[model samples]
Target: MSTMIFSRTDETPGIHGHTRDCTGAKGSSTLAKLGKGDIVVVDAPDINRTLAQKLIDAHVGGVVNTGAFTTGNVPNFGPQMLLDADITLVENVDPELPGKVKNGKKGRLNDGKVYYGDRSIGQGEVLDEETARTRFLDAREALIDHMEALSGNTAEFVSTEAPLLIDGLGIPDLDVDMDDRKVLVVSPDPQLEEKLKSLRYFIREYDPVMIGVDQAVDELIGHGYRPAVIIGDPDLISSDNLRSGAAVILPADPDGHAAGLERIQDLGVGAMTFPAATGDATDLALLLAEYHGASMVVNLGPTLDLDRVFDTAAAPGTPSAMLSRLRVGNRLVDSTAVAELYRVSRSGGGWLWAILGILAAVVVIVLIAGLSGSDGFVDNLIDSWNNIALKFQDLFS
Candidate 1:
C-alpha cells in the first residue's frame, strides 16, 4: 500500500500525517520526488486530476487530497482509485495551523505542508464521517477561491493585448495561397513533437499555409517542411532559423528579447515587430496569418488547458494569443483534434486493429452481462450494438 501524506486548511490542529515536503520545487518536481515513497500530497481540488492520475499511474504511492472526495467538476477519480488500491488516504490539515517553521515565518496555511524546506506539518485529527463531509465542502470552497484568483490573473494578462490585436487586423489575401502545403510546428517536448506529426497529415491534405510558431520551426525542418513564417520573440527559437531565410516577427518589447530582429532586417524578410506586452505573440501570429490571407490556420502543440497555461507562463509572455485564437472560431484548428482525426491510417493494419478492438469490446460486454444475469444490461447493450451495426451497414450498402 502506498502512503500519501498531505495537509489541508480545513483540518484541526496537530495532525501529523497530512503534510509532505514541497519547498524546493512546488509543482511537478515536488510531486515527482514524492513518488520515491509512493507518498503524494494533493492539496488543491482545482489541480487537474487528469494530471494527478498520470502521476499515480506512474506508481505514486498514494494521494493525500486536501479537498472533497468528489465535487463533481474535477472529480476525485484518481484519489478514489488510490483508495481502492488500499493506498493510505488522509485529508483536512488545519487550515489556520502553522505549517513550515521557515526563517521565523511560523504561522502559515495548511498548503505549506508540501514543501522541501526544513520543518514539517502533519495531517490533523481525522474526522468522523459527518464532520468529514462538512470539511469537504469547506475544502471545495477554498479550492474554488484559489481557482478563481488564478483565473482572474490569467484573464487580466490575456486582456492586456486585446487592443493592439484589434488594431492590427486587416483583410486576409486568399489568392496567393498554396493548396495542401505541409507545415510543422516545433516544441522542445517529444510529446508535442508527436502531436504535431499527427496534425501534419491533415494540414498536408488541405495544403494551407504552414506557419511555424517559435521552435516549431525545427519541428517542420526535421519533417522536411519549409516554414513560411516563424513567429515568436527570438529567445526561444534559434536566431539561425531567422537568419537562414525564414520570415520572422519580433515582439516590440526590448525585454521581450525580440532576438533576430536585426538579422531579419539584414535578411530583408518581411518582419513585423509588435510592442512586447503581456499577451502571447503566438496569438499575434495567428491573427496576422488571418489578416495576411491564410485560409485556415492549424495549431500544432498549442496550449489548451489551465496547467499548460501555467507552464507556458514560465515562458516570456501570456498565452493570450492562444486564447485569442479560441475566439477566432473555425479559423483555427486545434492540433490535438487534428491528431486524433489522423492518428489512424486507412491502411490494412489500422483497419484490422480497430475491428479487433470493437469485436473484443463486444465479447466482453456479452460475457459480463451473461454472468451478471441482468437482462436489462444485455438488452440495452444489444440495442445499442444493433443501432451502430445498422448505421454502418446502411452506409456501405
Candidate 2:
C-alpha cells in the first residue's frame, strides 16, 4: 500500500455519515457502488491488510464490523491501518447490524456507540490509534503460535500431496514455452493498478510471460498489458477478454470441482487444468511457471511478510501457497524487491545514456564546424546551444 497522510487531529472523533452494507464483501464487488465518505459495515474477522487498503481507498468515513477487527489470532495490521488513516473503526458490533441498518441510512459513531438517525442501533469496541497499536503489539506476541500452526499445516499439506510436490505429478504440460523466461504472475487486488503502473519499466524491459490470476486481467488490461496466460476462475473474467487469445489454465482440484470449466465449455474455449490444484490461482501460476522452467517468477502485489500472508492469500486448497513458494525457492521474487533494485539501477543508468548521447552530439557538431572551415559556424552553434540549454533549464526550474 502507498503511504497516506493521517487526516485526524487530537480530538474525540465523532463521525457521521451514510451507511453502506458490506457484510458479504467477499461474495460481491461492493466498492464500485460505494461512495466516498459512506460509513461501511462489514463482517470480517481479523480483517486483512488488502481489504483494509481497499476500504481506505474507498475513503469511508468509518467502519462498523460485526466481527473482531484483529481477533488476536494472528498479527493483523488491518485495525491499525484504518486507525492510521483517521478512519473511525468500531469493531465487534451486533452480528445482525447489517439487517437492522439499511444502506443509505444516516449514522453517527462516537464513544463506542452507533446511532442511526438519533436512534441507538448498536455499540462496540471503538479503536483509536493508541489502542490499536497496543493490540497489534499484543498480537505479535502470538507469532510463535502462528508460526507453529503454519509449519504444522504445511507439513500436513506435504504429507498428503507428496506425489504432487515430490514427483511433480499432475503438473500440466502447456503449449506456452517458459524456458528461461521471467514469468510475471499478477493477482487481482485494489492496489494492483497502482503497483503495475510503477512496474511498467520492468515489464517493458523483460517482457515476461504475463499471467493473470482471476480478475487481475481487469487491471492488467487497464494498464495496457495483455495477459499471455490466465489462471483462475474464468467466471470472474469478462467473456470478451477470455476470447482475446490468452491460454486459460483452470484450477481443477482433486475434490472434482473444476472452477469455471462449464463457462469455458459454453464459450467453446479450450483450457489446460492443473489437476489437484491447491492455494489460490496465483499459487498455481507460480507452480506452473516454476515447473515450466521460468528463470524468475515475479509475483506482483503479494507481501513477503508471513503475518499478512493468509489474510490475502488464495490458500488452503487449489494449491498450497507455503509449499508453492518453497517449490519455487529463489526464483520467486515479490514486487517490492523488484521495484527497489530495478529503480536504483535505472536512476543511474539513465544519466549514463544521457551523457553518452550529449558527448556524441558534440563530436558531430565539432566535426561539421571543422569540415565547413568556418569559425563563425562554431560560434553560431555555441550561441544556439546556450539558448536551448537556458530554455530547458527554465522549463524544468
Q: Which stretches of candidate 2 lie over 4 Å from their true place?
A: 1-148, 277-279, 309-319, 374-397
Q: What RMSD value applies to candidate 2?
A: 11.5
Q: Rate the local accuracy (lDDT) of all candidates.
A: 0.53, 0.79
Which sections of candidate 1 miss by over 4 Å?
A: 1-162, 165-189, 254-270, 306-322, 345-397
List TM-score per model, in order: 0.49, 0.61
Best model number under TM-score: 2
The pairs that clash in candidate 2 are 277-318, 278-318, 278-319, 278-320, 279-319, 279-320
Per-residue accuracy of model 2 over 1-397 as CA lDDT, tens digit each = 8886874332335777787888764424665567678888888888889989998998888888898887765778898888888898888887777777777876777777777655777888887778777777877776665566666777787887788877777778878888999989899777897678768889889999989999888668767888888888988998878888889888887775787899999998888887764637777788889888999999995654544553323234412766778889999998867887878998979989999999999999766654553557767677667777999999999
Return the top candidate by lDDT: 2
Error of model 2, residue 253, in angstroms: 2.0
The RMSD of every model to the true structure, in order and in angstroms, is 16.5, 11.5
